[model samples]
Target: MPEGSLYRMAAADINAAVVFEKVSKSFGSHVVLNEVSLLIPKGAIMVMLGPSGTGKSVLLRCLVGLIKPDSGRILVFNEDLTRLDDQRSADRHKLFALRRRFGMLFQDGALFDDMSVGDNVAFPMRQHTKMSEPEIRARVAENLERVGLPGTERKMVSELSGGMRKRAAFARAIALRPDIVLCDEPSSGLDPVMSATLDDLILELHRTLGMTFIVISHDTAEARAIATHIGLLYQGKLQVFGEAHTVLQSSHAHVRQFFERNTQGPIKVL
Candidate 1:
């Protein structure tokens, strides 16, 4: 059976892929996230959108334990990552185990310039698994093909087009067949056509992989195209969150200003 099919089979047993209860994070005196609460269902495509520096990426990073919150609870795969202390042997073990359940696609592809595309895709597996080299190679090829990058395994990261680089990073992200995928600014620098294409690829992955997706982005079009759920963050707080249609219909001034892309609202043009 396919990995997605397996996830679908297990979906009914899982309550939520991720849950946040009054989560907050701060850097010294500057708050980045404030009492944000959310529940992300399994297999749902949830987009976290906001202006730059509004803590969109911070939310995703928190989900994967890359950023620890100062207070409140965040549950990813039932593990309280915020509570895990790497100082303890057992907690450190638990942290790594929980993190493995998630795959992340960072901005700018973040591919190793020296590694071949195939090797980049294979890197995660090599780091985390004991699979034979041939098996690892086969899985790398399959994931690359899934991202529509077939036959480019030997190509260097420098040799790829911008859009292709994005796809290649995606291939690397899914190499571990994680239960959830987190994307940071997946549409950052692409043209409309390529951005839409990337959106389609994301949709395909969610549909076929049966994994929950949390994307940090600012593109309204991409969110409208791909999100089943939407969360709007501003000034380090989640101003609104709900089903796509509900979020779109929100009457909040901040929400209105954001959707309208206007310079006249709460988001000051500095």
Candidate 2:
């Protein structure tokens, strides 16, 4: 099916995995996100596109509760987020449990250079689980194999190439086998071939794991290849959003010019 039709069908369905409503955020005097709202469906790849500092990253952080919104609500699986409190407080335990539902692949991989590949992958399980040392080691190896990084358990983070580091980070992200994976700039810093390979790997994970994906990136080519849906963020606002191909075909000058890489369009050059 065409990508546009696929996105429309998904959006019309009532069972969205993640929903944002009238969300806004700011840093001091500068507004970062202005009443931004979007829905990312379950088991779908929703790529966020924007120029640098346009709140794409900010939006992701908001979704994970790393950054709170100044106003509006964030709902994951239809639960109010701002009400989340400590595990001991009322139904707050349920909200805290939701934290485990996501695995995030941050920009730059964020691997600890002091740790070995296996330890890096094992970090999350260590923090979140009571699993014994042996069990954690076993899980680490399994995750590494899952990411096609098997047998590199003792490898130091600094010794790996940029692509390898990204893969290792992916292994770490999936170690907990969460229901959603949030990736930031997943294809950045890699050559075209490596980027395509990364895209294929991400698609494979989506197909096999059935995990929801929220990818924040500016790479239009990568977005076209993997995004089931797309949203455009500009000037701290959600300028356009829909299925990937449909939104890209937008006649809105800002959308058209940004995607086409036209310098003379509505997106003011910095």
Candidate 3:
């Protein structure tokens, strides 16, 4: 059997919420992901760690069908995303439906400055669902409360503190009750206490909702706090991947260098 066929067979686990089979991508001559295959179990909080420009965010974008891989397959709930081209009218609905399963919190909050907090959280529902204004309002209030920002609905986005903005963004991300939440550097630009607080919010949401979470971060502390599964990508390859504790204990030079913050290891500054 061909090597690609073997990867497809291995990626066909029914228990997996997402799978990447021999996926690769390149921008011009710059290779971002090189045959990276991974299986993310249903409801697992998988934290992807890597140095800057190692394709951590690229992998996440591929999972959501925003960027198609150059080769291989990406499966979400057993449906292959690479086969569906969103730019093609025939595949748009299928692609949109597949994307609805995911909620993405961008590196920056990405909230609209002109919108009120309530309106921001209501945006997705208004765009995606047929819920009435009253119903959307109720759901908006509930999501804000879940993110510990209850009753701040009327405030402008400018009125929120940095941490509050992130929390508000979290509320919007979960507003539609997506099955998978993708957090891109949730703790970036925050004080340690605020970062910890965000981490706690993640834990609380995962515990209560039982949704799958894939977090992209440079923070080992965040991974230690919330990752059930962990993966480290370097130089366009996955260096280590397994349960959080197992990967933490890995003897891989790249993994150790990252977690230990050693400057003299295999990972060179770029």
The clash numbers for all candidates, in the given order, read 0, 0, 0
Q: Ten residues in a row with the worst lDDT in model 2? A: 1-10
Point out the higher-scoring one by lDDT: 2 or 3.
Answer: 3
**Each prediction's RMSD to truth:** 6.0, 4.2, 1.9
TM-score of 1: 0.93
lDDT of 1 by residue, 1-270 (tens): 122333333333466788777788999999998888777788889999888888887888887777888997787766667889888999999999988888889987899999899999999999999999999999998988898999898999999999999999999998899999999999899999999988999999988888888998889888899999998898877778888998888888887888888899888754
* Tens-digit per-residue lDDT, 1-270, candidate 2: 123334334444567787777789999999999887777778889998888878888888888888889987777777767657555576567766787898999998999999999999999999999999999999898888877788999999999999999999999888888888999999899999888888998999889888888888889898889999988899877788888778777797777877788999768879
- Which residue pairs clash within candidate 3? none
Residues 1-270, model 3: lDDT tens digits: 125565577567777888888899999999999988888888999999999989999998888877889997988988889998777987888889889999999988999999999999999999999999999999999999998899999999999999999999999999888999999999999999999999999999999998899999999999999999999999998878889989888898888899999998989997
lDDT of each: 0.86, 0.84, 0.91
Query: Model 3 off-target regions past 4 Å?
Result: 1-7, 87-90
- Alpha-carbon RMSD, candidate 2: 4.2
Candidate 2 regions exceeding 4 Å error are 1-14, 86-88
